[model samples]
Target: MHQRNISTRLKRRRAGDPMREFDALPPELRRWLAEASLPWSPRSARRIWRQGLKTGGVDEALRRLESAEVATLKRDRLAQL
Candidate 1:
């Protein structure tokens, strides 16, 4: 239930050069990108990200988002039923 200063983490990430140009992103965009990189079941990933927001880091949050996006894409593909 603790909130980490994501800005600080981002600054560190930028300094480390693990990611280039993330500095220009808004927090929401950054979070979304992080989510897009996770490997999990779509629904489960969304749930995990929601939970992670309560106590997890940005990386964890991103993984969940990624899963959720995948799930959504799959669902959409199936919707032409």
Candidate 2:
């Protein structure tokens, strides 16, 4: 369901082009994507890092990355259920 939500949101963005679509999302959602391990490429992580740098500078980007780790834990818990 979480995966589906991400996909659906992405589909509505930037002519179905994922990179542009991803770039279009807000920081919170981008952080969520960075943390979620659903068949993503290393480039996606790089993109999130770049987005972080662009919007809020290095510190904010790092903070977002840190928050992303928390999502991993949540995703794992959800998977277990």
TM-score of each: 0.40, 0.44
Task: Tell me which residue pairs clash in candidate 2.
Answer: none
Relative to the true structure, how large is the alpha-carbon lDDT of every model? 0.48, 0.56
- Which 10-residue window in model 1 sums to the lowest lDDT? 5-14
Candidate 1 lDDT score at position 45: 37
lDDT accuracy of residue 41 in candidate 2: 36
- How does residue 40 of candidate 2 score in lDDT? 43
Scored by lDDT, model 1 comes in at: 0.48
Model 1, span 1-81: residue lDDT tens: 422322211111112332444544447645565545222233343455556676777666765565655675566556645
Q: How far out, in Å, is residue 55 in model 1?
A: 4.7
